[model samples]
Target: MAHEDASFTDISIQAASSHQVWDPFVRLFHWAIAGLFVANAFFTSPKHDLHHWIGYTIAALVGARILWGLIGTRHARFSDFLPSVSGALNQLRDMATGRRHAHIGHSPLGALMIYNLLVTLLVIAGSGWLMTTDAYWGVKWPKDLHEIAVNWAELSVAAHIVAVIVESLRLRVNLARAMITGKKDIRRDSR
Candidate 1:
């Protein structure tokens, strides 16, 4: 028991000595977006302040995330995970053929979804922002656009959840849990 404890301590020290992977800002932004999204879905609606507050929170979180992607830690940078169309298609092909491999960064399909999420949030935030400006107040166009953006966001989030389920089952690991903990444990050479 004593020997096992000592080995655990050594591993903890080694992990701590390793370079910090997820910056605190990135982690905070991630959880903030996730929480706000959930709150918007369940605790807010168009008829209440809760809805507006949640939306603003989500927008702020997305804005911060965009800024962070431009200049955050290595793993959190957009360059680390943005997927090309061909890459995404190839990942789909690999999935169809059971040839997908584990990766350190987002898989191609997942990366595409990440891009979609960011873009959708931007549109949503823009529309919501317009609603507050005098020039766009009560504008039907902005309302319609915001609703469309929300729909897209909802669909993308649903797809993301489904993909997470599929990946968790396929990889024998919880991807969502990794998002929360910022540590994914997979064979180093799996990909």
Candidate 2:
């Protein structure tokens, strides 16, 4: 009973020390994109108006995110998390060496993943939209590109989920919860 009480207190202290990371718009944008992606992929019929609207909404969200990346909060800006090959390699090295370095913002590999998903989604949306236009109507390449991009996005989402879970375990940080609550409980000793 005493041990349980001590552990609970420790957890409370850790939670209290959590730093604000994700802003409201970032969180909303993430979940909105995720939900809309799922709805369009699995629920909505391709020929339906709902599907087209969702695609447009996703494209709009991505555009807004790009603008936000230019002029948003500290962690939301593109300058804060530009994808770097060397940085990603270092992160991979850290993983291989079992060195846990928790990043306050998105890690290098995470930044790369973010860029990949953003571009892939944009491609998917663009190709999808082109399919609806008279100029690109009955175009095989756009349809092919849309299908390919969707598959890539799905794979990327799966990888992102796996990476998040692995990273949370490795760093002892609830990253998913951070996205939800806009705070990350990073340990003081970690960099």
User: Candidate 1's residue-wise lDDT over 65-144, tens digit each?
Assistant: 88888887777888877656766665566568765355445666777888888888888878887887899998899989
Residue 7 shift from truth in candidate 2, angstroms:
36
Error of 2 at 61 (Å): 0.3
lDDT to native, each model: 0.69, 0.85
Model 2 C-alpha lDDT per residue in residues 83-114, reported as the tens digit of each score: 77777776787789777666777888898998
Taking all chains together, the TM-score of candidate 2 against the true structure is 0.89
Q: Tell me how far the alpha carbon of residue 42 in candidate 2 is from the true structure, in angstroms, after superposition.
A: 0.5
Candidate 1: regions farther than 4 A off = 1-23, 188-191
| Candidate 1 lDDT for residue 190 | 40
Highest-scoring model, lDDT: 2
